[model samples]
Target: MIELQFSPEVANARATGSPLVALESTIITHGMPYPQNVETARAVEAEIRAAGAVPATIAVIDGQILVGLTEDQLEALGQTTDVAKLSRADLAVCVASGGTGATTVAATMIVAHLAGIRVFATGGIGGVHRGWETSLDISADLLELAQTPVTVVAAGAKAILDIPATLEVLETNGVPVIAVGQDDMPAFWSRSSGLRAPLRLDTGAEIARAADTRLALGLPGGQLVANPIPEDAEIPRDVIEPVIAEALSLAQTQGVSGKDVTPFLLDRVFHATEGASLAANIALVLNNARLGAAIAIATTT
Candidate 1:
């Protein structure tokens, strides 16, 4: 049995049967610098709380899976260097080795299911990378969605990825990609990907019913709730595409691969956009957090 250490707040929430949303930790460790990382994390948790749900930020430390973290834990995690960025492939290995690791989207879903939390909020899910045909490099996040029974609320797949190919993979895997309040799937940092979503649901209640129906039907996978970034916060695709292109080229030239590719690309995009990308990222994550909280509440109702 895997050992789970739930923080006091999360333990109380669980015992009281309150709605809970699982949050991934890689955003703190791999997505940004220390003080800002912790600040953004706390803001997200506060958003969830304001929206009537508890946020459970999942991580692994000393071979134990942490369902939630305290303020001190969050601060320490944000400042800690060389933390393993864990996904399905290496989650167990890290745990077995007693390593401290930040859970990525895939790892968070796995741990959320174990913790009996059914909803998660993230900035974006990783998907088929650009040049996937040559590199055949796909993120474990896509596969995790196809198997884990946790409803994931993300802005969409990261705009840096091949959006069309990622959508195709999700369709092929029979994962429902539901765009919230829109027909066009969202592109991270932008409101539209120019690709029609396979499904559309306008409200948290509608999404909750869909998730519950899947559970009743014994469906094996979860649903992807593609929440668009707020209009005021979005960087238009036209302005961001060239920036992404430059960043992608830089990444290719640098030979950044595997797990390192995402953070590297994001960092380049951040610099290229003069930190606008990070600001947009934080906005989208908070947006997703509110929706995640609503979905968690709707699930109970």
Candidate 2:
């Protein structure tokens, strides 16, 4: 048996048939430290609400699919330790064992789609790790986007990955990577990756229309909307590139690989930039939430 618990806010949205955007809980559980993580989660949810949509921050708690978490739930999840980081392979096991888990981008999409939600907002989509051919350390997020029909709005793959390779894999899988308001892809904390985007969509309506067209044509997967970080909040490619290089070097030195690589690099970069990275992360996620709400509203009409 499975249970679905909704926060009061989300329950009302469901009853009203209002647009709701799915948010991943990993940012709270794994992205930052306690109060800040909880604070950021609420802010992101508020951004969605203020933009005229509901936010369903998905997680699995004691075998239940928690579609929306309350303030207390967010605090507990943020402060709790040993929560499993879930993906497609482990999602069922976590549920079966009655374990608490944070939903990654892939896992969140699966949960949201099952709940009939069509859009998700997240900080970034994971991708092929640098030097991936040896370790084959690709993030399940890419595969999820290739198979799931839930539209994802993100700042782009975390710049910690091999951006070009990530783009190639998405292309090979026929996933539409649309850069919102720019010709180039946004590099998570940075405004540009210095690589041309495969497609460009100016407004949330265009992105939503594209998603609807895909379903109408029997397309199998969803869209990757690469919404850019605001200029004032961006770290700028030039200034941030060296910091990333340093972080990657430290990761290699410490033998960090596979699932640990991203978080390790992110922490290192956060320290290197003196907290600039974390600020940019918060900015991009809030921005994506705004755009995601717009897309969710469009899907209903």
Candidate 3:
């Protein structure tokens, strides 16, 4: 049997049949630095609770899958070093090996489904990398969404990815990419990706209804709720485009590839942008969390 543990709050929420939203732990362990990471995580959980849903931040710690973490655990995770970045390919292996790790979007979706939580909030999803035609380095997140029965709320795919190819993959997989409250698809730190979204949802209730309808129709995959970052927090596409290109070029020059590409590029971009990217990232995550809670509440009701 898969070993799983739930904190008292999540356990009570489950017992009461209350709305619950799943959160990925990579944001805390790998996305940002300490103190700020822990603070942002707590703020996100509080946002969910304030919106009438329980937040379950999923992670694997010492062979056990933790569906929810206590405050101390969150702080500890932020301070811990060398935590494995657990994705669909290695999530089970991490569990079997009794390793400590942070769950990525795909891994979190799998665990959320197993725990009966249908709604998840995240900063952004990974997708087809730039120059994917040559590398074939598509993220497992797309495939996971194609089959998992959990709705994911995010700003959209990471801006560093090939947006057009990512959309095509989602279309081919029959996954609905619904842009929330907008006609344009969102870029992770920016509000517009320069392409139209496959679908658009105006409210949390509409998103919830679509998810329910899909299940009723026996659809195999989850919905991608492309919630836009708040206009006030967005960095604007034009402003960040050249910055991203510069960061990508730097990555190539520095020979950053595979798992190291993202973090390396992100660090370079963060420095190039004078910390604006990180600020925007935190803002979008909180925005997604609030919407995720609303959708979860609608789903449960």
Q: What do the candidate models score in CA lDDT, each in turn? A: 0.95, 0.93, 0.93
User: Stretches of candidate 3 above 4 Å error?
Assistant: none
Q: What number of backbone clashes does candidate 1 have, counting pairs of residues 3 or more apart or in separate chains?
A: 0
What C-alpha lDDT does candidate 1 achieve relative to the native structure?
0.95
* Per-residue lDDT of candidate 1, residues 1-301 (tens digit): 8879999999999999999999999999999997999999999999999999999999998788999999989999999999999999999999999999999999999999999999999999999999999999999999999999999999999999999999999988989999999999999999998889889999999999999999999999899999999999999899999999998898889899987888889998999889999999999999999999999999952
Clashes of 3: 0
Task: Kindly report which residue stretches of model 1 are placed more than 4 angstroms away from their true locations once superposed.
Answer: none
lDDT of candidate 2 over 203-279, digit per residue (tens) = 99999999999999999988899999999899989998899898888888889887788889999999999999999
Ranking by lDDT: 1, 3, 2
209: Cα error in model 1, Å:
0.4
lDDT: the better of candidates 1 and 3: 1
lDDT of 3: 0.93
Query: What is the lDDT, from 0 to 100, of the residue 144 in candidate 3?
Result: 98
- C-alpha lDDT of residue 154 in model 1: 99
